[model samples]
Target: MEKIKRIEPFHLRKDREYEPFLQFILKILKEIDPIFHFENTVVSEDRIDKPYVSLKTIKKIGTTNQGIEIIIEELYEQVAYDIAIERIIVRPYGLNVDLKIEIESTRDTTDQPYLELRLIGDEIVNNYILKLFTQQFQQIPLDNEKLKRELLILNTMIKRRQWYTVETRAKAILDNFPEHPQALLALAIARAAQGDLEKGEFYLSKVLEYQPENCDALYNLGVIYEQRAEYQKAMRLLQKSLVLKPKNHVVLWKLGQVKEAIGEIRDALNAYQEAMKTTPNPESKIFTSTDFRKEAKEAIQRLMK
Candidate 1:
């Protein structure tokens, strides 16, 4: 039996939007079959009518004495295809969004895993990466504690690419988790995204002070320097990060850029090719978002000619 690890009963508020102070960590629980089912659950052993996502499972979000209607979609190669929820099921289970996941084993090879992430109580539901619930309403939120929900919402906003909202949420997170590395990184990225590299640099530098060799922080800082045309500084940092995360696609891509900028076409081409060869962790969902993967391929093609 699937035990309730945690339960922040769902609440419904239409037209409810996101807040900037929230952050989220997408986690995968169990893997199921790829033939999508709503009322059916996909579990380890085949059972009667087990769907990965369904109205029964989704109704939990609206179980707070209300009903909700939302749409779920499959994103194929940057194109989003929608799955409409014609009506809200008022049953005890929950759903109504595009948060889905698929079995990742090579034996179950599908073109891509149509994963959806949803934040359920403290023990996140291993679902819904699309959005996080907020508590602007009177009812108890997806999580009883407002702060946790805020973090979830913030992460969702970041995934959605809402920069202004991310900056606001990042500030909120920093105010509370003062030394939280990820929160600091989020804020720095938010600032850099909005064209304020100096502020971004300051926050990232702070992160490095706490965990000096953090590859993500190091890589991001290096990118910031690259943006500022400080090639030597950027090169030094990127090289340091590569030492830690030798196969990191983003790091290798940045190295390609830095080398190209320094008039080292041959070295740049080699770096891009190396980037193309790196394999990312499928569960982290970083591969899809790493545009440099495609860029690296294109760059190699261009350079070879």
Candidate 2:
């Protein structure tokens, strides 16, 4: 790729006019005859306001053009349950830019799709390429691999009420898949679990916008309403989720809570008893229970039914 010495807005170098340089990097991406065959590669522009693009590809780039050598290393990182990175390294760049690329940093997860490039070598090519590719992928697509990681985080950490970790992971998931139902729901749970009821409600409302009447969305939103003492709306959403999943003991238990909150003693007792009859284990589904049986049994005892 031929580097342009001058850009139209050359005066704005301090203002992150690096997009002009990335044009050359993009050209190089197309021209280079990669020895490794990249698979599952996809490029997308996620945000309209963002100048960079997100690229995700699976490739084994460990060899050279003329069999010389490349910056090679096998660093394993677990992305999720099924998708594990066996070998993580810079693209096989021999006599090419050797910029330190960070796929995802640990700080704020909400601002993403931007691939970070840290210049390591003193080579001119390295500096040019580093600036060219820096923040190129503001964030990658959530795809399936990222979803799996979010799922595990949701079930294990969020369920345990670890609000900080849950919030970070959910933000990471949303960085790629913005307003994703699962991630949105997880964020809602994290906020609500952390006692930030209003923010929790906001997240669930966003989830409903993407998928209205989504079982998990409906139930969780209902639970939030119940917590806030909005018995009517809570019952409405919880009942809707129940029609879709009648055997959800957790939902039934929540319904009982809503009923009791409004002083419907008999109705609450019946709902609590019904919830007690259902199974207490959470399955692989997204918006299901986390074993509220103990809570339901205690509620039943408190109601003296």
Candidate 3:
């Protein structure tokens, strides 16, 4: 069984929208032969006869009184679906607009997962549902807390090497925040990590469009250029990043490599020596088995010959 889960936020006017939203989701899941399970067992059923259940049966679901909670499972013989809806009061006048949806899917694949599959891929299903939801309701304009959570999810995906998932999450953020720097940065990292250097470079350029002085974007783009053997471009970007953060040993090391690549032995040696002398930042997210300082020192020695 292959399972994927995502927690996504939405913006609806009030608790009243929860039932309609639930109906919308149920309509989509109907394509997959879904069974609904409600917290209020009185309304739970093996099959839902009416497309939209009567409000009397699901009273005050998203309100502070009852909170919208439902679980749907047994999707066909090969798939299982689960949806959890939640809302929080984060505004004044009892006018709450925050809604969070947690969707989980588990699929049991036969020998021919794609060819013989009755439903579409899980990722496609999620994207389709989210896209339709945004059109049916409102796309959430993320609050600061929501933004932090979104970025945290991207970071975790990157650490786990889930590049495609990172792309989806980043694109979801961009749907709400078109010029969000961190979202663009995440897309850049995801594209680059997936070996799509051209797309990665484009996304990094977008990041720079919003945050011209973003050191991480500059450094990453410089590394990409270096990989492409665009030494001059790499040197320019790395030098700009170094000016912004003179003590960044990783940037210095990268700059050294660029200079070395361009046959500027003296400049390369200077950069490497600087990298060797600079103290590593304890808070840096870059992790490597080799000591960068030792690597820089070795580069200097190699260049001295």
- State the RMSD for candidate 3: 14.4
Clashes of 3: 0
State each model's CA lDDT, in order.
0.53, 0.58, 0.60
Candidate 3 C-alpha error for residue 167, in Å? 1.8
Which structure is stronger by lDDT: 2 or 3? 3
TM-score, structure 1 vs. true? 0.51
Give me the overall lDDT of model 3. 0.60
Candidate 1 lDDT by residue in tens digits, 130-218: 22312221233232376677666766776677765565555555555688776787777777766679988999999999999887788
Q: 1-305 in candidate 3: lDDT tens per residue? A: 23222223221222223345456544654453233222322322233323232112222333343333443323222122211121221111111222223332222211100101122245556556566655655445677788789888887777677765577677767877889988898888887876779989999998898899988899989989999999999999999988887888889999999888888989999999998988675554432222489889889888888
| Best candidate, lDDT | 3
Q: Work out the TM-score per prediction.
A: 0.51, 0.54, 0.54
